[model samples]
Target: MSDAVDPRRASAALLALGAIGLWGTLAAISTRVTAVPPFLLTGLALLMGSLVGFKAFRHKPPPAAALALGVYGLFGFHFFLFLALRLAPPVEANLVNYLWPLLIVVLAPVIVPGIAWSTRHGIAALVGFSGAALLIASSAGSLGQGAWLGYAFALASAVIWSTYSLATRRFSHFPTGYVAWFCALSGVLALACHAIFEPSYVPKAPEWPFIAALGFGPMGLAFFLWDRALKRGDPRALGNLAYLTPLLSTLLLVLFGGGALTPLSIVAMVLILGGAILGSRK
Candidate 1:
C-alpha cells in the first residue's frame, strides 16, 4: 500500500485537473486541426510526452512490470480515447468516458483487496450516475450515428482506463517518470500502427501548433500528473475526481459559446460535484 501523505498526491490532482481542462478544449481545437488524422495527432502527442519523460529514463531503466503498465496506460487507454474523440464531441465523449470512476467504485474492492465497499461509495455512484444521465438525456436529442459510435468508444475507453488503473497498483515501486516513459512507448507503438495502416495521413503547418499543445498539455504533462496521483493516492479516491471532467467540460463549453447552461445541466453538476466530494472523504 502507498504511504499516506505522499506529496505527489497534490501534484497529481493538479495535473489531472489541468489535463481535463485541456481535454475540454480539444473539441474547439480539433476542429481546426482536421487537416491531421486523429491517429497521427495521437502518435505525435505520445512522442512529445515521451520526449518530456526522457529525463526519467536517464537515471535508470524501468522494470518489466512498469513497462507493461505504461504500455496499457499509453496505448490502450489513449488509443480508444482518441478514437472516441474522433467520433464525438469532446465534452460529450468525456462525460461518457468519465463513467470509469463508477466502474472503479464497482471494481475497487476486488482490485484493492483490503478496501471494503461502503455506503458512501453507493451514494456517490448514484449521484454521479444521476448527473450523467441528466447530461446524456439533455443532449440525447442532438446525437447522430457518429455520436452514438463515439459514446460506445468512450464507454470502452472507460473500461480500459479502469483496468489500467488497477494494473498500475502492481508496480507501486516504479518512479513516476519511468511509468510516464512506458506510457510514451505505448503511444509510440500506437503511432507506428497508424503509420503502417494510414500512410497518407499528415498534419499541415497550420495544425502543428494545436498538435504541439495537445502533446505538452494533455498528453505529456497530464499523464505525468495522473501517474503521480495513482502512485500517491488510492485509485478509488482518485476515481471520484473523474467527476471534475464533466463539470469542467460543461463550464468550458459555455465559456466557448457552445450553449447556455440549461437548468438540467446545472442540477447535474451539483449532483456530480456533491457526490464526488462525499465519496472522496475517508
Candidate 2:
C-alpha cells in the first residue's frame, strides 16, 4: 500500500465532494417526486447509470475481480440502501447507512494486514457515534415503526458497503473506467431486483426528472468519481470527506423546512466532522 498522495487526489476530492453534496440533496428531490415509487426510482436510476457506465466501459474493460466487486456492490450496497430508504426517513436512513466508516475501521485491522488500531482512533469513533446519537435523539419524533425497519435495512446497507469498499482493493489493478462499468452493472442488477420484487410500480410524468437526477447525478457520475478517487487516494481520507454528507444534508433540511437547525445538530456536526478528521489522519 502506497502512502504517497496522488497528484490527482485534489481532483478526486472535488468529485467526491460533488457526489456527497448531490447525495445529501437526494432526500429533498425524492420528496418532490413522491408519485414515483422508491423501487421504480432506484431501478430507473440504476438503468440510467448503467448506460453511462457501459459507455465508459467500452473505453476499458475490467478484470473478473472488478466485476465480482461490482456484483457485491449491486446486491449488497445499493439494493439494501434503496430498501432502507423505502422503510425509513432519509435522515434516519442516512445516519444508519453512514455507519460504514466505523465498520471499516473495525474491520481494517483484520482485512488489511499490518494496519493497527490506536486509542486515538477509538476515541474519535466514540465521539462520532455520540454525535450520531444526538442527531437521532433530536429527530427521534419523526421516526415510526416503518422508520425502525428502515434503520435495520440501513445498518445492513452499511455492512454491505463496508464489504464492497474493503473488497474493491483486490480490483485496484483494473482501470477506473472499468470499475465504473461494475458500478453500472450493480445498478442493472438493482433494477432487475426491483422489477421482480416490486411489480406494479410506475412513475408519473412529473416524477421523471427526479428519477433522472437520481440516476444521472448521484448514481451514475457519483459512483464513477468515487471509484476513481479510491483508486488514487486513501480510503480513510475519502471516508473523512464522506462525513460531509450528514452535515450538508442537515443544512439542506433546514433550508427546505424539514426541521429547525437546533443546538444539538450544531454540536453533532462538530463531533462528526472533528472525528472524521481525526480518524482519517495519517
Q: All predictions: root-mean-square deviation over Cα?
A: 3.9, 3.6
TM-score of each: 0.82, 0.82
**lDDT for position 277 in model 2:** 75
Top lDDT hit: 1
Residue-wise C-alpha lDDT for candidate 1, range 185-282, written one tens digit per residue = 77778778687756677677887888888777767777776766666666666677666666676676677776568888889888888877877765
- In candidate 1 the C-alpha lDDT for residue 153 amounts to 88
Quantify all predictions' global Cα lDDT against the true fold.
Answer: 0.72, 0.70
- Global lDDT for candidate 2? 0.70
Model 2 misplacement above 4 A: 1-12, 59-61, 82-94, 142-152
lDDT of 2 by residue, 98-130 (tens): 787677666656664455666666666666766
